[model samples]
Structures are given as C-alpha cells and as structure tokens.
Target: MSTVTTRTVAYPADGLTMIGHLALPAGDDRRPAVLVGPEGPGLNDFQRGRAESLAELGYVALAFDINGGRWFTDPGEMLARVTPLLADPDRMRDIGHAALDVLLAEPRTDPDRIAAVGYGTGGAIALELGRDGVDLRAIGTVNALTTGRPGEAARIRCPVWAGVGSEDPIMPPAQREAFTAEIEAAGVDWRLVVYGGALHAFHHPPVDQAVVPGVGYHPRHARRAWRDVVDLLDECVPVPG
Candidate 1:
C-alpha cells in the first residue's frame, strides 16, 4: 500500500474562511487530482477520509470545505444553510472555484488531469463547476440530481456521472429525468446510476445527529458509489507514470 499524507488547508470563499483537507500519495511524481465536496452538513471525517483513500489510489485529493468548516447536527440547520446556496449557482461556483484553486496550487497535483466529485449540495456544486466550463476531466455527483440554468450544460467539456437513490424524495425520478434530459440536449457525456432501495444521502455513513426525513445511510450503496467514482477517475483522468 502506498503511504498517504493529509493536511488541513485554509482558504477564502463565499466571504468566509474555508478550511479544506488535502491528501497526497507517497512519491515525488505529480499525479492526477480529485476535488471532493461534502454534503450540506459540511466537511466531516467521512469526506476527509475520502481524500486520503483517493491518495491511496495514486491521486492527490482535496476535500473542500463549505459553510466555513461548520458542520450541522440538526437537519433543519443543514437545510437552512444549504437551501439558499442551492438557489444560487454563482455562489456555488465561487465556493467550488476556490477549492479548485487550492487543488491546482498543490505541487503534487497534475493540473491537466483533474476531476470533481461531490455529495448532496456539494454534488450540485460540482455540476455547476462543469456548467461554468471549468477544464475538468470528469465530474461525479451523488444525491444531487439538480439541474442548472437552461442551456448552461453545453459549456461542459467533460463527462459527468451522477448517482442517486431510487427512492430519494429529495431527488425523485422526475428530477433525475430532467437532469438527464438537460445534459443530453447539451450533448454532454453523462451517466446516472440509481441504487435500489436507497434514500437521499445513502452514500453517507451513519450520523449521530438527526437527519432529514428522506435521508438514510446505505453502507452497500455507499461503497458501490465510491467504486463508481473511482472508476470514473480511472477512465477519464489517469495518472501518468
């Protein structure tokens, strides 16, 4: 197994001090990079561990912070903070861009080979980054099947993958169809995976705090989603030897 090192990174975004977590693989060689975004609750141990796991797979990974590093234990608090951000795509882009800059500035990241993966509200931010025409190799989102402003997906220059729970009321079948239609119309390469019997935030591990009505943890689907994201990276952003 390759050694992985991690560190806390502080940056400015959305008029707040954003704290991100960066993980790097053991070696001097530059490698492909992945930008990870956490769900509405904000950057937690799960998301930070994801960056480290990606580093183990030979990619430099950054788990960017949202909400100025504040995590919510109450469902209402999480929604209240994330709802407005979801309504504003430009704000989401600003947060994502700040994190992207952090990843790009890393000495070990191969700027040309980069991907973005996010969960829930973070997933929407990843999609927005693609719409904003960031030079990403690929974009993978989970539980954020939200559509962007009309005709904006055409600007995306890379493939996109979205994963969602079949029973997720927050991202129901109608929303998923609309997201697919928009991407397809724009001629963007995209794929959507629906995990059976799962609910919103199924990719997340169990939390001790109260969650929203439709939110539940599915360990199996969570592992599957992680594998899918890794597969997307392996296909679109291969690390150079």
Candidate 2:
C-alpha cells in the first residue's frame, strides 16, 4: 500500500467554521482529486476513511464537513441541523464550494480532473454543486435521491452515479423516480443502482449512536457501493501513470 498523508483543514460556510479531512497520495505528480461529503450527522471516521482509501488508490481526496465538525449522537439533533440546510439549495452550494476551494488549493490536485462523491445530506450538496454549474468530471452519491430546483440540473456537465437501498423509506420509489426524471430531462449522463433488501444508510458501518428509524448498516452492500463509486471515479477521472 502506498503511504497516504492526511491533514485537517478548516474553512467557512453558512456562517460557521467547517473542518475537513484532506488525504494525499504518495506522489508528487498532479493527480485526479475527489471531494467527499459525509452523511447528515456530520463528517465521521467512516467518511474520513473513505478519503484515505481514495488517496491510497492514487487520488487526492478531501472529506468535507457539513456541521461545523460536530457529530450528532441523537437523531433529533441531527435532523434539526440538517433539515434547514436541505431546504435551501443555495446554502448547500455555499458549503460545497467552500470545501471545493480547499481541495483545489492543494498543489497535488489536478483541478481540471476532479470529482465529487457524497453520502446523504452531503450527497445532496454534491448534487447542488453540479446544478450550480461546477465543472466536475463526475459525481457519485449514496442514499440521496434529491431533486434540484426546476431546470437547474441542466447546468451539470458531468456523469453522475447514485446508489440507494431499495427499502430506503427516506428515498422511496417516488423520490427516486423524480430524481431520475429530473436528471433525464436535463440530459445528464446518470446511473442509479438499487441495492435490494437494504435500508437507508446501508453504506455506513454500525455506529455507537442512536439512529433514526429505517436506517441500518448492510456490510455486503456497503462494500459493493464503495467499489461502484471507485469504479465511477476510475472511469471519469483517471490519473496518468
């Protein structure tokens, strides 16, 4: 395994200081970069680990924060913080852009070859960035089947890949249909993978905190989803050898 270095980064968004985890691969050459967004609760170890794993695969990865670097153990607290953010697309874009700036500032990042991968609330933010006309090479999201404002998705210029559990109540069939319809209407290249018999947050590992109803961890599907996201990045933003 190549040596991957990680560091803490702080940036401002939504009138608060947000902390992000940045991981760099062991190479001096410019590399494809990825921006990682965490679930609603906040950026946790799982997301940070994902950034590290991407770096190990020879990409510059940054796991950006959504909630001022705080993690919520209570479901109500998590929803309280994330609900308002979800309701406002502009706010989501502000957050996403701030983190993106941090990623682009790194010398190792090939600014022209960058992608975004996010989970849950973070995933929604990634989508918002695409809708905001950010020039991303690719976008990959999990457990987030959110629709953008009317005609906004037309701004997206990259391929998008989304993964969701079939049984996810938060992103039910109707929501998924709406999301796909919007993407299709915008003429974006997109793909959706439905993991059978899984629930919301299936990509997450078992956490010590109390989660809301209908969210559970599915180990097999979690690994599979990671592989799929990696494949998406490989296809869309390959690093030169």
Candidate 3:
C-alpha cells in the first residue's frame, strides 16, 4: 500500500458550504480518482476513511459532503434532509457535480479515469450522476436502489454495481425490480448484489445513535461488500502502475 495524505476542502454546493475530505496517494503524479458519497446521515468519519483507503490503493479520492459539514444522529433530522433531496434528481446532480468539480480540481486527479462510489442516500447521488450523463469509469452504490426518471439511465456511460441487503424493506423486491427494469431498458451495464440476511445499510458499521427502522449492521457482509466495491473499481478504474 502506498502512503496517503488527507485534507479538508470547503466548497459551495447548492447554496450550502460543503466541506469535503480529499485523500491523495503519495507522490505528485496524477492518478485515477474516485468520489465517495456518504450515507443519508451525511458526511462523517466513515466516508473520510473510505477516501483514505482508496488513496492507499494509489487513487485520488474525495469524500464529498451532503449536509454541509454537519452529520445527523437523529433519525428524523436525517430523513427531513435526505427525503426531499432524494425526490429531486436535479438537485442531487448539482451536489454531485459540485463534488466532481472539487475532485477534478486537484492536480493529482486523473479526471478522465474517475469513478463514483456511494452509500445509502449518497448511493442515489451516484446514480443520479450516471443518469445525468457524467463520463465516469464506474458507478458503485451500496443500498439506495432508488430508480431514476424514465430513459435517463441511458446517459450512463459506464457499468453500475449496486449492493443491498436481502431483507431491506426500504429497498424491497418490488423497488429493486423497478430499478433494474429501468436500467435494463436503458441498455446500461448493471449488476445487483443482495447480501443474504442483511438489512438496509448493511454495509455500514453499527452506530451508537438512534437510526431509522429496518437498518442493522452485518459485520461479515460489510467486509464482503467492501471487497466487491474494490473489485469493481479494480476492473473499471485500476490505479496506475
């Protein structure tokens, strides 16, 4: 693993002051980049650590924020913010694009070889970026299997891999079917992985605070999902030699 450096970056996104975390692999050479979006609770240490992990693998990673610099521990507060955001694809795209711009601005980032990997509500943001037609090497979403507008997925220029819990009522069979149907009809290269006995946000580690219903952490499945995400990035956005 390469040495990694990290920093905090503040930028403007949809009238909010978004503070992002950027992790860069050692050395000055430009490298493939990835944008890490956080769960609905918003950006926190978990996502920042993910960026650092990506950097250790020799990629430039920017874990962008969703709720300015604040994170929510209250379920209602988190939903109050994320629910409306989920309903607006354009706004999601705006926030994502703003993050992309931040990642691209880094001198060490290889803009052409970038990918987007997100969790929960952040996962939806990643999908929106693909649907908005951003040229990405790959899109990986963990949970948040919400579908996009009809025919919008055709704009996706890269493969998409979504991981969800098998028993997640929030992303039940019917919703998954609907999401898959839309992507299929759009001719997008897509794959879905349902972890057995896992619930929504299964990839997330257990938090001490109150969480919304139908969410529980599966330690084993979390590791598996992370491996799958790394595998997808390796295939589509491998770090430079």
Candidate 4:
C-alpha cells in the first residue's frame, strides 16, 4: 500500500456542516478520484479506512459524512434519519454533490476520472448522483439496491454495479428484480452480484455498538465486495502509467 495522507474537510449540506474525510495517495500528479459514502449509521472509522485504502491504490478518495459527524449506534435513531433521507432523492443528491465538491477541490483529484462507491444509504446517495445526471465513470454500491424514480434512471451516464447478500431481507429477490427492471428498461449498463448465504450489510465489519436486525458481517464477502468495487474502478477509470 502507498503512503496515504488524510485530512478532515468541512462542508455544508442539508442545513448542516458535514465533516468529511479526504484521503490522498503519495503523489503530486492528479489521479482518478472516488467518493466513498458510509452506511446509515454515519461516516465512521470503517468508511474512513476505505478512503485511505483507495488512496493507497493510487486514487484520490473522499469518505464523506452525513449527520454532521454523528455515528448513530441506535438502530431506531439511524432509521429515523435514514428512512426519510432515502425517500427524498433530491436531498440525497444534495448530500452527494456536496461531498463530490469536496473531493473535486483536492489538487490530486482528476475531475475527468471519477467514481462513487457507497454502502447502504450511502449507496443510495451515489445512485441519486447518477440519477441526477452526474458524469461519473462508474457507480458501485453494496447492500444498496435502490431504484430510481420513474424515468429518472435515464439520466445516469455511466455503468452501475451493485452487490447484495442473497438472503438480505431488506433487499429481497423481488426488490432486486424491481431495481434491475427499472434500470434495464432505461437502457443502463448495470450488474448485480449477490453473495450467497450472506445477510444484509455483508460488506461491513461487525460493530460492537448495536445489532441492527437483518444485518450481519461476512468477512469473506466483505473482502470480495471491496475487490469487486476496485475492479469496477480499474475497468472504468484506469490510473495513468
């Protein structure tokens, strides 16, 4: 892994000061950039580590925050915030664009080569960006099978890849089918990977805070999901030699 430099970035969105984590690789040249979104709980260490990991891979990465730097361990509190946020696509786009702006502000970021990867509600935000017509090289999400509104997916300008656990009650087979049908009908290039025997949030490491029902960690699948996201990035926006 390359030496990575990280810093805190504060930006405003959704009437709050969003504290984001920016990670840069050990280089001066501009490189492909990525926006990393956290799960519904908030932008915690796991997500920040993901940003650093991406930077080590030679990409500028920003692990953005929601909830103004609060990580909600209470399942009810998390759902209270995320449930409404998910229903409002415009708000999700606002949050995503705010983070994208932060990522773009970094000198190491190559504006032309950008991608968005998010987990859970964070993934929903990335999808909102694509649906809002952002010129993304790729959009990858885990445990987020959110489908766009009617005719909204037609605006997505890049390929989208989503990963889910086969047994995820939150994103059951029927919901997955609907999501796929929506995107396919809009002529979008998309693929969905379902990890067998896994539950919801299979990509996240187990948290000692609170046990959110239907959510569990699968170490093997988590690693595989990360590799899959990296593959999507490499395929869509390769680093310059």
lDDT agreement with native, every candidate: 0.93, 0.95, 0.93, 0.93
Better of 1 and 3 by lDDT: 1
* Per-residue lDDT of candidate 2, residues 8-70 (tens digit): 999999998999999999969999999999999999888899999999999999999999989
- TM, every model: 0.98, 0.98, 0.98, 0.98
Q: In terms of TM-score, how similar is model 1 to the real structure?
A: 0.98
Give per-model CA RMSD. Answer: 1.1, 0.8, 1.1, 1.0
Angstrom error of the Cα, residue 181, model 2: value is: 0.4
Candidate whose TM-score is highest: 2
lDDT of 3 by residue, 58-160 (tens): 9999999999998999998888999999999999999999999999999999989999999988899999999999999999999878898888999999999
Q: How good is model 3 by TM-score?
A: 0.98
How much is 12 displaced in model 3, in angstroms?
A: 0.7
Candidate maximizing lDDT: 2
**Candidate 4 per-residue C-alpha lDDT over 81-146 given as tens digits, one digit per residue, 9 for 90 to 100:** 899999999999999999999988888889999999999999999999999999999999998999
* Model 2 ranges off by over 4 Å: none
